[model samples]
Target chain A: MISIRELHKSFGPLQVLTGVSLAIESGKITAILGPNGSGKTTLIKSILGLVKPDRGVIQIGEQVLNGDCRYREDIGYMPQIGHYPENLSLNDVMTMLQDLRGGKHPTDTQLLEKFRLGKEMDKALGTLSGGTRQKVSAVLAMLFNPKILILDEPTSGLDPVASSIFKDALIEERAAGKTIILTSHIMSEVEELADAVVFLLDGKIRFHGSPTEILQNTSESNLERGIARMMQEAVHP
Target chain B: MRTTGKIIKYEIRDIARSKFVLFYFVFFLLLTEGLLRFGGGSTKTLISLSNVVLLVIPLMAIIFGAMYLYHSREFTELLLTQPVNRHQLFRGLYLGLAVPLALSYGAGLGLPFLLHGFNAEGDVALLLVMIGSGIFLTFIFTAIAFWISVTYNERVKGLGFSIVLWLFFAVIYDGLVLLVVAWFADYPLEKAVIGFTILNPLDLARILLLLQMDASALMGYTGAVFQRFFGSFWGISIATVALVGWTAIPFWLGLRRFAQKDF
Candidate 1:
């Protein structure tokens, strides 16, 4: 459902994504795996139109992403940090979103209850803890149930229970045929939730296939070890 | 428009809780009341009130608007990733800031004037220009601040440039003008001076308000040629156009910079 072609981006002199291309199919969870400075986030941000690429095109369905912001209507992005207006209470934040979205989506009570965020809706964003803030970000990302979900470090601050709930939600969304592109360091989570693995390093795709292929190529039983082996192999080969 | 309104709604919520905006409101309210009570006499109080409006409005607008953009950078980025239009996002931000700031100045200076019994037809017309000048300054300077913030990614550097810009207009600019006029005193530099006034938004505001308050105070300095020019409808209209130009130029520059910017 989403396609990226020759995506290249650089911050100053340092190149982030250099001539990278990939396609993310619908009805599946694709985990973008990379080390620090691997340009994984840059690639994701480019697709979300957050980080303007130095060169290339990103096509979602039949339309190319352009200056017209109507394209973003299909996207639900959860940034790594749940940064929000400081003094805005959760209700105000959500209401404002609803108004700006042109009354597109209804209330998202399920995720609110799943994350136990109903009680915290009245608190100002600045007053919330990091994990709680992550929950808020997660809810916002899923609030619209958009065509594609771009989640960066979606479970970093969540507790085990909350993480599991989030994973279950991801599985359920995949079942509903929504495309999800997520980046995370948690290998077990990736192994469980992601159907396809797109391994990136130095701004190029090193591996793109099923999760089982990643393990088979590296001859590693676990997703974590398999990824580590892939990196080591890239360095030597 | 509805999108702009909703964005403005959220921005107002944020600004409503801003410590600087709150402090600004309180400061003006107290300053106006204090000036009216202590300065004494209708004319003196009006002049004093007008002077502070000319000075403080632009200063606070620049400082507060720049700082607000910096502080709300995260929130702005958060909204940018949404389906909201960029133009609406920026227009809302500008209006959201400009509205509260202009209102605070209006209510602060306005209420005192109303209490002081200076609402005659002529006085109201003059009061409007005074208030209009204050609004213009707030709009213009906030636009400049937004421009600086948009151009520079670093907060300290952006704020540094913004403060220096304010200093140039508020402090150094007048010094440079005085030096220019003094050095060229032998020449009838009325045209040059008028051109110079148009260049500086602060000077343009001061000239408009000062002429309305006490034309004679400036008549001696501006002279008969300049006096006739400034005292006429054409002069006021030109100054008004210049104020609106000042408001539009920087705001448009800021919006352009914001449109291409990747958040």
Candidate 2:
């Protein structure tokens, strides 16, 4: 389980996260949905101990995430746009990552081979297409079989088949009792994967509940409409 | 042990292929040869070579090292996501750059020495030229470069700032210091001038070698004071401490900021 409390952050004078708090239960998927500059990314970074919060506590299970903290070992992260050194081959990257993680665990190599990355493992990372890079990123995120997975815009450059396979893997991981936190603009993807949704606007949680419950409470039938309704409610309420 | 070793190896492998590193090595080697030829194989040639090499060496170190830091921004984010600590990562980066730079210096100077075998003076010259200057400049600018990189996000901006500062130290700073001393020449300002010398690494370097060249007569009363203070073991140790502080302080801050930075 991951728990965040009273998280506040700002850059210079422009406050980003403002006393935000949220929680993730074990063996579940929680999707954080918000517009650009709404502090969704900041929230994720704070959880990972990348960004220091002005005020708050973040705990992964029982251990707080801080400087030199090893709580990162439990989380696998896939950034929005993955970038590697231009000269590194895919195999080199994988081996380097495995070395850093300190041991080899079960990676979904069969699926990766199916994606045809096995054949081109020797090719430099800079030469790969965007979709291929996303595939590599997705593969590494799941390679460790981490207790928690944090993916930001994971499906942006993926093909339909690859996206389907990736989603299926998330489902499998969730079934096996790992917590997943993902952020995406794709409503259909969120609707498909999110067991619950946390709606954020202007660094505050507008709403937090099941996707179906959010829609039902807001008198909206679709995720898009539900989000729109919540944003409107946040403005007035 | 295993993880830190892997980080070190990976950093080495990545920087080994950098185009800037290749360019710096070739350019400096050629520059050194050109200066030797221009000086007509005289002792004056060695002095000129030392001055130029020291000036150029630190500049190259800063530019290339800064490039490594900025270019690897996203990759750093990826690294942080792993189970590695910031200190280990920094050690890897520092050693990685230092190894290649040290090798390039050796190769560049060694090639020239092999072409012309070392006499007593030539060996001393080469030791100061290749070994001393190389290590001193590398340590000085590696810290500066890493500081610029971690402090700034934009590549062009950070590098541009470093270039301007390099120009000031290598070319303009001495001239400015001279103007200041000349303006205050009547006030018995030898001690103040000596004090001012501590501010610039270039000046410290010049004082080190010039004293060895036995140029105290040309350097005047201020020279005697400089030689009295800086000529001693304490002076060299002081400069060494300052240079090491240059590395330690900035590296400490950069690592601190980097740990809290949102990649």
Candidate 3:
């Protein structure tokens, strides 16, 4: 479980996250929905300890989020855009990561094979297309089989078939009792996967409940319209 | 330790495949041949060859090494989130860069020695002093590069500052020291000159190596003073200790700053 309390952060004079408090349960898929510039990414990075919060405490299980804590060991992060060294081949990257992790992990060939990346192992990362790069990032994140997965724009560049493949893998991950936190603007994608929805607007939590409950609160028939109406109301109010 | 070794291996591999390293090796090979032919390959050509290693190589190493460290900050930040400490990261980077330094210099200097059959049973102590002083000079510059890279987030700024520092060490430093000595010529300034030499790794390296070469007699009054102060075994030992300080101080500061950096 992930717990954040009274989190406050600012970049210079621009306040990003203010008294942000939330809990993410294990074995559940939570969709963090927010309009652009609404602190979604900030919150994620703060939890990852990449961004320091001015005033707050974050806990992953019993361990607090400190510089030395190995809470990161159980967490896998898929950045919004994955950047790799231009000359690095896929296999080279995998081997390097494997070695860096000290060969402690079981061989994770399933994700590579599933994504059809085995054939492209020798190709340079710079030569790969955006979709292919995303596939590689996705594969690396899941390869370690971490108990917590934090993915930002996880399916942004995927084709429909690849998207299906990703969705299936996420579902399997959830079934195996992993905590999955995903951020995406695609309402349909969120609706299809989210067990709980946390809607954020202007760095504030506008709504937090089941997806059905969120839709009901906005009195909308569709997830997209519900999200739009909620955001609009949050702004106007 | 295992993870640190892995980081070191990958860093070395990355540097080994760099275009600049390849181009540098090729260019140095051609340049060495041209310069040797121009000098007609004489021991009297120490000035030209010394300028290559002293002035040119240090300049290039500072720029390329600083740029490499700065350009990889984001990647380093990613690694920090893993199960690795700051000291381990620093150890890996230092070791990784040191490998390429030793190999490239070995190739550059060794090639000429091989072709010319450069053989001399010079003082063993002085020979060891020369090699130690040269490598220590490289270490000091590399540490300076790493420190600048960590202090500045922008690659261009890092490279710019590092180049300026290298220029100061390579040329301006000696010029300023000459002016000071000229201004104070009447007093006993031998100790002051020795202290000034300790301030710059390049000077320390030159003094150590020149003592080994036949050109020590040609360095005039300043050379005589250095020979008097640093001619003994204990004197060279003191200079080596000072050179080690040149490496350790900058490196320790750089590692400390990098450990505390948010990224």
Q: Which 10 residues in a row give candidate 1 chain A its minimum summed lDDT?
A: A101-110
> Which DockQ-derived CAPRI band holds candidate 2?
medium
> Which stretches of model 1 miss by more than 4 angstroms?
B19-23, B119-122, B185-188, B219-231
Model 1 agreement with the true structure over B100-136: per-residue lDDT tens digits: 8888888877787778776344667677888889989
- TM per candidate: 0.94, 0.92, 0.87
Cα shift from native, residue B209, model 1 (Å): 1.4
Tens-digit lDDT string for candidate 3 (B1-263): 76678888888888877766666666655665666567664353444656566776678767777977876664576576555767788878877886577556656554654576433445334334444555676677888889899888887888889988988988898799899989998998999888888888887677666666647565545455777876745555766788889889999999988776654
- For candidate 2, the TM-score is 0.92
Superposition error at B51 for model 1 (Å): 2.3
Candidate 3's displacement at residue B187, Å, is 6.6
Which of the two candidates, 2 or 3, achieves a greater DockQ against the reference?
A: 2
Residue-level lDDT of model 2, residues A104-130, one tens digit each, is 555556557656778668899899988
Between 1 and 3, whose TM-score is larger? 1
Q: lDDT score, residue B47, model 2?
A: 59
Candidate number of the best lDDT: 1
Query: Which residue window of length 10 is worst by lDDT in model 1 chain B?
Result: B218-227
Worst 10 residues of 2 chain B by lDDT: B117-126
